[model samples]
Target: MASPIKVCVTGAAGQIGYSLVYMIGSGAVFGADTPVSLHLLDIPPMMPVLNGVCMEIADCALPCVREVVATDDPSVAFKDIDAAFLVGAMPRKEGMERKDLLAANVKIFKVQGQALDQHAKKSVRVLVVGNPANTNALICSQYAPSIPKENFSAMTRLDQNRAQAQIAARLSVPVSDVKNCIIWGNHSGTQFPDVRHATVAGKSVYDAVNDEAWIRGDFITLVQKRGGAVIAARKLSSAMSAAKAACDHMASWWQGTPEGSYVSMGVFSDGSYGTASGVMFSFPVTIKDGKWSIVQGLPIDDFSKGKLEVTGKELCEERDDALAVCSAAQ
Candidate 1:
């Protein structure tokens, strides 16, 4: 057996973390052939809950989990870790402003970024799963100056999965048949769930559906608002699906995406596809050897271009807001 790879999950007591940790422990993220030492972290008040989670993990006796450590200390959770799922963040209250939420999360991620820089492996792969994830990832990368920006990414795979599933259901085809469904820009409502290049069983999605009105109207709107719809139906935010998407993301990042296919990931923008240079933006990406590169040369129609611009603007605004919060604290 390979040496145990150290993995960390923040907010391990939360619903998503509860689902995600079991996946990671069962070798869902890193695979069954490799063993993992799981490090779980949450707030001080959540430690007891975290400990109960650890007990359940031990009771499961997952063969891939060689060890388990539950704690409230970021330093302990992060130390020499190979991968981190940063799922913990301050949830937005009913009356709270967006800027106020950003301010609170910026403080959290900044400290975590510093922890990652000081203690985690140089090659540590960090995925920010918290709300306002793109800007939070940007803040994390900024604070962890010693860690390469490429190592930090926010979860957009959930949005991509939602788009793909919606397309599959509309076409009455298995979800596995949907391919190349692109989720562009922010994970928020401004996100563009583009199927211009998507296909169902090798047929163009446009032709498969043959309804331009639905594709451009209901299809797009539904995918963009799916999270809200989920929350409305369940009276809680998405957890099971979100956990699955997070697993899909890390697994692809670790193992590599299939050839001739791309997935959406919120990575630090290098001005690709006319996006602004320093914000975290989601783009169709292909992975190889644990590295991700933005897919290039997809001709964006005017409509798609406009959608991209709107989401890009929102991300830039968020980046600016997070930076202002940081500056204020200093």
Candidate 2:
């Protein structure tokens, strides 16, 4: 049997954390055969809530969960961790601009990243799930100089999953039938849900539907704005779906994405597709041996290229905005 892995989750008392911890404890993130030691972290004020969460996790009595540690300190939470999920950040409030939101979260990620560098295993994989996640991940990576840049990622699988569901519903097919729904650029309204290379059960989605108008119009907008739509309807941000997407993101990273299949993930851009370096941008990626490589050489039409340009610009601007905050702090 493989040795137990340490998994740390920040914001353990929050909605998404509440939704994700059980799945992680039940071997959803890793595998049923592997044991995990969970480290739950939150702010001091939320310690009581985190303690209750730990109690519930224990009550589940999962065979795969070996130990649970609840703490309010980054040093304790990140100590020798194998996988760390950076899920806690300040949410965007009424009238707050995206730059303002980025400023608010950058400091949090910087501190956490330093803690990870100081305490976590050198091979630790980090996923940033909080809002403005791509930039938050970038900030975290900046602080963790010893950790590989490839080890840090942000959550864009939620957007990809939403895109797949929209396409599946349109074609009256099972969601599992949809493949290669790529989410490009940031995890924001500007994200491009590209279906140019997508397939539905081994057939090209373009030839299956052939509705360029709807694909360019409603399909893209729906995937990009789905988070806002969910908030509007539920009067709360998407907790369950977001948590499930995080699980999917980590699981796919650990267990290889299927052959010839890919998922969109927010990884550091290495000048791929002309995207700027050091920014965490969502691109279609395949995982093998617990590492992700960007899918290369996919055809980009004029429409998709234009959307990529817009989203790429947005991500660069966000990177700059967050970097400015870091500089100001110094």
Candidate 3:
């Protein structure tokens, strides 16, 4: 076997972490041939829970999990790690403003980002899965100046997968048939799930479904609101699907996507498509050699342009809010 790669997962005792760790150990994130050592991190209060999780993982006899280190220290957990999943963050409760939530998570990510800068491999790939994820990712990347900005991304594959499933259902075809489904902008309710460039079994989604009305109206809203729908029906946020999407996000980034297709990842923008720099915005990107390049020259009609602008403005405002919060703390 090859040398084991260290994989660190924050919030290792939480719902998504529980599902995610198992998947990683089972070779869902990395390839089955690659050996992996898991470094699981959680708050001090969750130590006992994290220990039990580690024990269960041990009991699973997963060969990929060569070694496991469960800790409350970010530096210890992140040390020399190859991939870090920033899944832990403050969850918004009843009546909390989005800005307040962003403020609360800023300190956490800032500390973790500093730890990553000091301890992790320079090439480490970090994915922020916490809520207000796009802005939170920006905060994390800001602190880790030594790490390349492209190495840090927020999860938008969940939104993309949701879009793919919805379109496939509408077209009465298997989800696997859906291709090039793009999720633009934020991961929240304002996300634009566009299937304009998508296809189902070699046919354009528009031609296959022939329902422009639903695609422009209910489909977009449904894709954006699926998270809330899950919370309402289950009394808890999505765990399994979220974990699966995180796995897909990492796997696809590590192993390149299809030749003509792309996946949505919230990465730091360099003023692409008129989005301001420094914000982690979601765009359709193709991966090659473990690096993602944004897809260019896609036709964005006036309506799509308007929606993109709305999400971009929201992200910029959130970035300002997080910066103010960080400044206040200093």
Candidate 4:
């Protein structure tokens, strides 16, 4: 086999980090064909816990895990990494406002971005899994000017999977029957899960269900709010499923889109459907050669027009907010 690819993850001590490290190390991700060397980056206070976790991983003795190193410094940890997974972020406490949240995350991503610019291998590709993921990724991309813009993406595949599950359950069909569903806009409560474009097996989802009323009043709302439902049902955050979704997202990114279809991800917009450039937003996209490109020339109806507009506007507002904070800090 060729040399092992080096993958680095930040926030290696959080709940998501725990699941992510194992799955990636276990050959569930990055394929069984390729061995991986892992560099886990955590905060200084969390390194001891990460060290213990590393010891456990050692016990697992996964042949795919060639080496595991834990570090609190990005420069030391990310050097020569092939891909970077940004899974660690500060969660907002009760009563914290969006601006405050953005301020805090921007500080973290800024340093990480600069470090990536300096130390990460020139070819490193990054995926940000932290909250406010799209905006956090935008900050990192802005700081890491040397990296190509297309290399930055935020995790919204969980939103896509939730849309699939909700649609399948309501339509009484398996998730395999659900196809072409698009998650428009950001990965928040305002997200629009459009079934109008979705297909069940080969039939249009709207026609497959044959009930526009249910699609309107229930499907979109359910998919958009499913995260809250999971938290309510499990009494804990959605980490395991989120980890699975991350695996799916990267899998699809490296693999080509299915024969004639696409998926959605938070990619840097190019003014499509009135979304501004340089800001990342979710759109129907396909991956070719490990790069995601938004599908062009799709027909957008009046319904999609409104849905995309609402989410697209929210992204612009948040982008401006993040930029204003950066200005004030300077």
Instruction: Compose the digit string of candidate 3's lDDT tens values, residues 1-330.
Output: 888989999999999999999999998789998899999999999999999999999999998889999999998999999998899987655445677778789889988988999999999999999888898899998899999999999999999999999888887889999999998888887889999999999889988888889989999989988887887787778889989999999999889998888999999887788877778999999999999999998999988999999999999888888888889998
Give the Cα lDDT of each candidate.
Answer: 0.91, 0.91, 0.91, 0.83
- What C-alpha lDDT does candidate 1 achieve relative to the native structure? 0.91
The superposed Cα distance between candidate 2 and the true structure at residue 209, in angstroms, equals: 2.0
Q: What would the per-residue lDDT of candidate 1 be over residues 1-330, giving only the tens digit for each residue?
A: 788999999988998999999999888889887999999999999988988998899999899999999999899999999999999987644445557768789989989999999999999999999888899999999999998999999999999999899888888999999999999899888999999999899889989889999989999899987877877777777889988999999999999999899999999899888988899999999999999999999998989889999999999999988988888888
Query: Which pairs clash in the backbone of model 4?
Result: none
Residue 65 deviation, candidate 4, in Å?
0.9
Alpha-carbon runs more than 4 Å astray in model 1: 92-97
Model 1 lDDT at residue 191 = 90
TM-score of every candidate relative to the true structure: 0.97, 0.98, 0.98, 0.95
Error of 1 at 329 (Å): 1.2
Pairs with steric clashes in candidate 3: none
Q: Could you give me the TM-score of model 3 versus the true structure?
A: 0.98
* Model 2 lDDT, full chain set: 0.91
Worst 10 residues of 1 by lDDT: 91-100
RMSD in angstroms, candidate 1? 1.2
Q: Which residue segments of model 3 deviate by more than 4 Å?
A: 94-96
